[model samples]
Target: MANTNLKHSSPQGGRLRSAVAITAILSLYSASAMADGGMASMCFFITYMKQIVGSVAVIAIFVWVMGYFEKKAVLADIGQYVVLGCMIAAMAGWFVSQAGLVPPSCSA
Candidate 1:
């Protein structure tokens, strides 16, 4: 009899599962933050945006370095560029919110 147990054999799979879990948790937190409007919510939103921007920057740099080494696929490069664009848009939105351009209900 042969027994095949492959669930824990792939590190990449484990990492992917962990990433999904973290994303789900953060999304729930974000929803709650939106629901709770106040100075604390504003601060949480800003902090979350900053964390996203930082993560994007890190991923972009990693992809750039990998591309330089000719180890990354073109699709990865494109994805990184897309993420960079989103990061830029997010930063702009944050600035606008800070400038009181956003609705008081959300920004306050």
Candidate 2:
């Protein structure tokens, strides 16, 4: 009697699984995208960015303090850029939040 205990191997090198996973993810995203006009996702992104801005600002301040003790002008310069980035990110987040205040003219 011939042994038939071999495991089945896919010929497509996992592509089939990857394709199915991508399709499922896209379907879920589309369903979510249709809900709330995407406000939930936008708010989530805004909140995340706000947190990141705060964290980056603190790190930049720490960098500035370290530069002060090290007396390295380069570190101070880098810190300046890092702080500038945090400020810009914060401003962007504020702008997005404020935009939510006024309803669109086309909305009924």
Candidate 3:
């Protein structure tokens, strides 16, 4: 019985352990990467705005469609996507303005 229980639980336990290990590794990677100024990630984020927005929009549409078919839960994902998109766009715009890619309308 103990052996059977161990056999039965090993795969699931291994998966959980691996997941936790991966999470820790990724967290460390991101923390170290961001310990500086995050110049690379910021550049990537700016360059990939369209891809990010499209990916999020696709997810939102998928959720909306699922909600349509399911009809049990409201499709709140689209709103979330819109909010995220707007926030990213605003931040990107700010970064661009700071980088002097776009000139400020007003002088300080």
Each candidate's TM vs. the true structure?
0.49, 0.53, 0.34
lDDT of each: 0.73, 0.70, 0.63
Tens-digit lDDT string for candidate 3 (4-74): 56655778877998999978975775566577556654444344554565677677667767766776355
Cα error, residue 4 of model 2, in Å, equals 44
Top-down lDDT ranking: 1, 2, 3
Q: Rank the candidates by TM-score, best first.
A: 2, 1, 3
Backbone clashes counted, model 3: 0
What is the TM-score of candidate 1? 0.49
lDDT of 3: 0.63
> Taking the tens digit of each residue's C-alpha lDDT, what string does model 2 give over 1-108?
743554655547468878999789756765675585665555444455566679989999889879878998888888889999989877775675578652333121
Question: Candidate 1: lDDT over CA atoms?
Answer: 0.73
Q: Which stretches of candidate 3 lie over 4 Å from their true place?
A: 1-43, 76-108
What's the residue-level lDDT of 6 in candidate 2?
47
Residue pairs in collision within model 2: none
Find the 10 residues in a row with the least total lDDT in model 2: 99-108
Best by TM-score: 2
Q: What is the C-alpha RMSD of each candidate to the true structure, in Å?
A: 6.5, 11.6, 9.0
- Tell how far residue 63 is off in model 1, in angstroms: 1.1
